[model samples]
Target: MTEPQRLSRRLIEQVGCSRREAELYIEGGWVTVAGEVVDVPQFMVQDQPVALLEGAKAEAPEPVTLILHQGAQVDDRSALASITPASQAAEFDTGKRVLKGHFRRLQCLAPLQPGASGLQVFSQDWRTTRKLTVEFNKLEQEYLVEVTGTMRDGGLERLKRGITHKGVELPRVKCSWQNETHLRFALKAPEAGVFAQLCAAVGLTPLSMRRLRLGGVSMGKLPAGQWRYVTAQERF
Candidate 1:
């Protein structure tokens, strides 16, 4: 019987590839041990047939970004905890493989306020971080706010024209009624508590707020408490 050895070493000897290349193949889900796929390059193997899957490449894995539909009651920490492999949305059609590494070192950008829910960004890519952090003011965030009480005539027009709060002028935002009770707001880099303040200024009491879009990305058909990978086609 052959002695057990690291799968990376076995692949190097079997296919005459470099150690790094072997590790890449294994980590990319290209290697199988005894017909079972094993992603860990350090897995021990002895006298077992190891084969590389067809079309396997030695390219480095791409950094991943995830969009989660945070629940209204769940806080940011709990929303992050729901990002396990089991919580990946069934409708997620991105061909990207779900790996343990994808969840590590993820930075949350644009976290929702307490009691609010909708699209949230989590990224392992520095580009995504830079876009959301350094250029955040340039991105437009869309929210659907449910409110009670009646708005005075021209309240929405006043909101779109801008308002003064605490003697400071607030930036202009596009506000319109989505329905009798829901207002849609397209705001740019709105500060915390600004939504409630604006609603109050307009004589409306906000009951709930749910973010629907940020920049070019929209939370379309993503069920609550589940997450999906940001596809290459997605800009934000």
Candidate 2:
């Protein structure tokens, strides 16, 4: 006889989904084994059966480290609005201002356009979020920008030093030339408001801006408007 194969209910646990979700998937005839659908959660097969589901793409279920490529028009208020209230409440208790403070502290690495997309990380807890935001202050943020006119050699350098705007001392940034038409710069605590300050400092309005990297993270292969879980190793 063929070797007896064993299966357990624990497979649902290992799949990083609730047993109810697993059961629903199984009942919906979405699960497959070696390319064959298995609609029964209690069904047993070999130690490993090729598992696939219609909407059950395997993802890193742990917390995520995000790298967003933001465009020119997106703002923080809109971005924060995308977060679901249910998820927010699950992560941090509702009706608690302290937790709201933690959420309010989430920062963006680049300014995004209304229609642009990039990477963004959601921390599992406030502590992890603080770590990522703090790391951004020390690390460099790179951007690929397009302006209205030709920029001088030191045009970017002036941005790196400091610029006063609206009677406020805007902090200096680290910038350099990526090409004659494209400028790259790194900033500490880059947020949506900083983009206006930068535009005022450079004396040129931003036509387009997209974040390329935050610290060592890049938006590699991640599609727009989609999210992936951040693993522990990817955390700051």
Candidate 3:
């Protein structure tokens, strides 16, 4: 019999996922061999049945990521909701069975306020999830915001520094006035309700807000309430 091999490599072969993903599972103590958790990627395993804990074993469908052009009208519905048959975006019906707790229960990384529509990136792929959520600070989310009302003196500078809202002091973001009524805001770490807070902090009443770009992805020409697959060549 051959000597044991690296647990991470063995897990990669068993799960058929990316090497990084396998390493993540192993390092997170999600991989088990013979009922023992294997947290070390370098652990040796020969013929033991490599088992992945429930949450760690989930795999997204082949296509992985789905890009939805959510509309400003359906503010009640999120981009992730488009995967449902009842959703107006019927094109998302790929007929692929995404196993339990797939994209259904998964909330979108960004929550678009009702009446504001724009591009949204979501995926059943764990890699995408990790990149979007865990490493979100590295990302920049672009938005077109239309507002009514004048700015508070130094509001633009304050917004650039960061607008303290609620109890916490929010992080700084890139903001510029596009026109008398339009403004462009690029948020790096988008905390919940940040868009609205930005408008409020700037002494502007938000008339409309639409996400134009998320990292390297853009809304492009896709009509609202519709969706398209993210091609393999594209990277966020």
- CA RMSD for every model? 2.2, 11.8, 12.9
Per-residue lDDT tens digits for candidate 3, residues 4-90, read 899988888887888888877776557888998766678898888888898764332243576777777764354455654243244
lDDT of 1 by residue, 1-236 (tens): 99999999999999999999999999888899999888889899999999999999997678899999998888777778789989998988666777777887888897675678899999989999999999888889998899999998889888989888677677688988999999999988878877888888879999999899999999888998889998889996
What's the C-alpha lDDT at position 152 in model 2?
A: 45
Cα displacement (Å) at residue 54, model 2: 22
lDDT of 2 by residue, 1-236 (tens): 33433222534645766766766556555567667766556777664554655465333222323333332355666655555423332322323212222233444533343333455554545566676655656755666666566544466667777877778787788776667656666676676656656765666656566666656666555444433334345434
- TM-score: which candidate is best? 1
What overall lDDT goes with each candidate model?
0.88, 0.53, 0.71
Candidate scoring better on TM-score of 2 and 3 = 3
Give each model a TM-score.
0.89, 0.51, 0.54
On lDDT, the stronger of 2 and 3 is 3
Of the pair 1 and 3, which is ahead by lDDT? Answer: 1
lDDT of 2 at 188: 60
